[model samples]
Target: MAGAAPILETRDLTIRFGGHVAVDGVSCAFERGTLTAIVGPNGAGKTTYFNLISGQLRASAGAVLLKGAPITRLAAPARARLGLGRAFQLTNLFPNLNVLENVRLAVQARAGTGLDFLSMAARRRDLAARAEACLARVRLAERAHASAAALSHGDQRKLEVAILLALEPDIFMFDEPTAGMSVDEVPVILDLIEAIKREGDKTVLLVEHKMDVVRRLADRVIVLHNGALVADGEPAAVVASPIVQEAYLGIRTAP
Candidate 1:
């Protein structure tokens, strides 16, 4: 996994809705086995860019490449089949499903089968093991049997991470992983992200607002303003850049 080729790349990517350009001329490369943070103020096109990359929305211009092959033309499920996994800003989970079943479903998706149909999922040793392990990684093992809707908000977020981890994707894209969480809950989510990169060698692309979280987790940071990259570099350097402060922080700070 460490020696894998470039997992994802966007070249001059732009997305337009009618006459409005949501993402304009955004080009960036995300390498395999590295954690990257995409940071920006609201309306800076962060979600729009992620939508284009994940194939939920089409790019008005430019191409999205996976492992050096163009995938902009591919659909979301097609991209998922090619080892691309995404977690939305809002928790998207089966509210009625228990944590284990939810994660098992993701594992089954990666395995190209549906355990609930032809197979008894509980008896599938490999899938159960993987799902449980994923839960443990997110600190949700204790609540593996709890209904997703019954869990606390933070636990639901952890469940979201577990579901994605169960997919075992080469490239993991997370949109606002820490949104609407308590101050203490933020680190819990951050710890799960760190565990993914450290233990799974997963390539992570995160869009986050918490400057502290970005500085701690990101190996490289990309800052966007007005739908284009304003700064991209080491966390400290990018945060210190005047363009980033002006667009993102509203006030310039001395470097």
Candidate 2:
């Protein structure tokens, strides 16, 4: 990761939906090759912030920068080409496609090659190899041929992550990667996140509701309340802060 700059930054970012503010004057940086988490309660503007950063929703005000250059004007695919990737809280896989083909399409999309027919998609040798690598990274190699709809909720989440990984992004933004997973699936999702941080050269920004996962994986934690950042710091310190506790826990008496 040498010579790599900060992959993403938001300067005084703000967003609105028909006169209602969703993210207000938020500013943060996601550095290259690190894992960070965003934690907040419902309507805390987590997903809205993600949408602004990933180019799905345009910011009403402020700048989104990639490598210190303004990217606020870029579209989602344009941002992806600049090495930004995102996974949704809701599963965003192609239900009709089998696992390999799903991932292969992502790889092909990122590679910017001309489209291939399904019959010849398997023969595109390089795309299949890259797709297999991504699936293997997420421990989904055994399920490569299964229809995506046939996989469990957890496997679908992993597949989503794997598909994004195939993009070879410098920054990976995950919105609640474990949203609908069972208890047993939590560790698998966590392990995949850990592996991305450990082995991939990607900077990760996760917005998660689960405090346990937030505590375990986050290098820095940012807490949002009422569309504003209320806490940002090392995970333990941020969690223990009175502001964070009050904002999310509603604790009034001294414990």
* TM-scores for the candidates: 0.92, 0.92
lDDT per residue for candidate 1 within 137-221, as digits (tens), equals: 8888999898999999888888888888888888888898888877887877888788778965689999999899888999999
Model 2, stretches more than 4 Å misplaced? 1-5, 115-119, 253-255
Model 2, global lDDT: 0.88
What would the TM-score be for candidate 2 when compared with the true structure? 0.92
C-alpha displacement of 16 in model 2, angstroms?
Answer: 1.1
Which runs of model 1 end up more than 4 angstroms from their true locations? 1-5, 252-255
> Candidate 2 on 1-255: residue-level lDDT in tens?
256557788988999888888999998877777798998889989999999999999999999999989999999889988888889888888998999989998899898874545457667898899999999888899999999999988899989989988987888899999898888867877887888899757799999887889889999999988889889999999889998888876675476
- Residue 244, model 2: lDDT of 81
Q: Report lDDT per candidate.
A: 0.88, 0.88
Candidate 1 steric clashes? 0
Clashing pairs in 1: none
